[model samples]
Target: MTTYDFSNQTAIVTGGAQGIGGAITALLASQGARVAIWDMDAALAQETAERVGGGALAVQVDISDWDSVQAAIAKTVEVCGGVEILVNSAGIAGLNAPLADYPVDEFRKIVDINLNGTFLVNKAVVPVMTAKGYGRIVNIASVAGKEGNPNASAYSASKAAVIGLTKSLGKELAGQDISVNCVTPAAARTRIFDQMQQEHIDYMLSKIPRGRFLELDESAAMIAWLVSSENSFTTGATFDLSGGRATY
Candidate 1:
């Protein structure tokens, strides 16, 4: 466990109420950042924030909706000071089905939340961080994005777009002190599994050469440094957390 300094910083973690997002929020708060947990479930977000207990704030946010995102930013800034770090962990796995069999509405919904949502949140926060001339961002993507999954077309495509967005944004802000990057992680045993079919889950597990799923703390630790001041040279990059599954 490597300790990183986040003293006097403010972090916004979307989907921060549960699963990977919750882990990120807790770790950030523990390291001295005033964290804002943004989720669609207002009650769960508040509960998670309260549990973090360092003046952590919670705001109901629909990352896919422009208005909702704007409102969350306003609330976060007012309550948590300023947004210097943003971890876009808010996303969904759509459904497990072949492309032809995938539900049209579900596909759209997944893209809306997983891809458009990431874009919306980052778009809203970039300027705030740029004004300060310092910021750190970590967008949570997936290994499926790199190596598209058979029955998970929507999730793969959406995350692949996230990787592209991170690259473009990172380059756009290359001159600035702020850094933008994303992590492509293998499946982790999180509440997200509830949205997936057991067969699909098994398929994902089989792809991991490490013979196991990723741990929440491991994801949190990697992200902590990526969003820290210590990570000065890397931006517009993709960090692999696929447990020997990523070839590139």
Candidate 2:
């Protein structure tokens, strides 16, 4: 029953070709916002963009690379006339293994894509928002960032860094009418689940008091509101979507 009028805004969702990102893209577009999807998957990204209607465009970009992210942002700005909202949803799953058995390279790769990519996108896009003095940003983090899932040390650490970045940047832009926030969602029924082991899956489910996987659309609903004008009072906070798993 939540209704929002975003007919005047332009929103960019990174990694918005599939899964939770695809859900977020469709939701925002339905609300009448000009949506641009940034993803590495060209065909799927283009397909989502088409489904979102006219004024929606898809650009292929690797978020982990700063130059690619910047280029995509520039393209989005050009297409949309200006960037008003951003949802950082692009990320790779980490190697689900113990620290001792974990390859250092794999760990670093997760950090680079999940953490550094989030940072670069924000840096590249914030300038436009700062110039306009109006913006809303939602960085998609995970519950692992908060409670630190045992085997997913890399993912947990990367998401934890996202939380830190959200708070820091939210504070920096709080006075400028731009709100920066992040969400800590529990195990979503997405491709990321396939990246985890059976034991890790069982371990995660046991921790969730609600005992159900989060729906992609449910998470999309939050991201849409945060990107909408209706979410106008909160900033620098970690909103929970943990199925009652998160105690703090």
Model 2: per-residue Cα lDDT over 114-228, one tens digit each = 9999999999999999999899999999998999999788999999999999999999998978999999998877777778888898998899999888889899888878888
Q: What is the TM-score of each candidate against the true structure?
A: 0.99, 0.97
Give the C-alpha miss distance for residue 38 in model 2, angstroms: 0.7
Which candidate should be chosen as best, given TM-score against the real structure? Answer: 1
lDDT of 1 by residue, 84-194 (tens): 999999999878999999999999999999999999999999989999999999999999999999989999999999999999999999899899999999999988999
lDDT of 2: 0.89
Those runs of model 2 whose alpha carbons end farther than 4 Å from true positions after fitting are none
lDDT, model 1: 0.94
| Deviation of model 1 at 219, angstroms | 0.2
Q: State residue 151's C-alpha deviation in candidate 2, in Å.
A: 0.9
Q: Which predicted model would earn the best lDDT?
A: 1
For model 1 the local lDDT of residue 101 reads: 98
